[model samples]
Target: MNNQSKQPISPTAHGHRLVVETLNTHPNALRRLHSPGSAENELSELIVHTALHLDTVQKELVDRCTWAAQDLTRVATGTAAPNSLGVLQNSGLQIDLLAARRADAKAHLRSALAAYQRVTTIAKPQHAGPHPPLPSRTSPRTR
Candidate 1:
């Protein structure tokens, strides 16, 4: 048999076996692909969950702010009830809070993405073989 044709066991194969062993031994590995109970995976999942929740909240805040602005406009135009002023003011405060929360959530989402990227990068296999060279274009003169 040609040495080139007979390949050695791949690192990826070893990694697969290791993952299988880990899944068999770890209590929580069966619950999720990333091992939900593990610290790193759990943190990543939590961050994603929190980011999604924050996105929903941000959308709601935007709607509320729009409604509040419409109410305030009505108040200024003497179309809204006098008691609506207090509610509009409180809505302004809520809008400010939501803006701050959105900023924080974006930051957390970035951090979580970075953390997850690191984990995936670490798991990826590095190719050891030399890369194939690009095909050369034959010039008219050469042909």
Candidate 2:
């Protein structure tokens, strides 16, 4: 039998997988409640919004990661303490929970970066300065 049939999936694991999938979805498609200010998107406005979002997401991920690090230290140093939820769970469980949270936050950050890159791609058009005039058709071309 396949691994799926071999064992039952825990709700926590299932939820963690869902969170990862949601975060990995295309940026524009993530929140379907609204469009980028109507179907006709304003490139500059979208870029600004996406950049702001990236910054926020990055900060959130960093914060969450910091928390996770603290938890890791607690687990590693064999210090007994309540997890983020104020539950005195076993160290193993605490570490697993913290890992899942960190993974989700990192996934979100990655998705935000992707969204920013997408919106800013067209924000600026690359143009080589004016090209030299076409070569003189006449044989007497200047050296």
Q: TM per model?
A: 0.54, 0.32
By lDDT, the best candidate is 1
Measured by TM-score, the strongest candidate is 1
3-120 in candidate 2: lDDT tens per residue? 3223443333332233234343233333342356642244323433453444444455455656767777887788956457644344446556656655665555555545545654
lDDT of each: 0.56, 0.48
Estimate the lDDT of model 1: 0.56
Judged by whole-model lDDT over C-alpha atoms, candidate 2 comes out at 0.48
Q: Report lDDT (Cα) of residue 99, candidate 2.
A: 61
Q: What is the lDDT of residue 21 in candidate 1?
A: 37
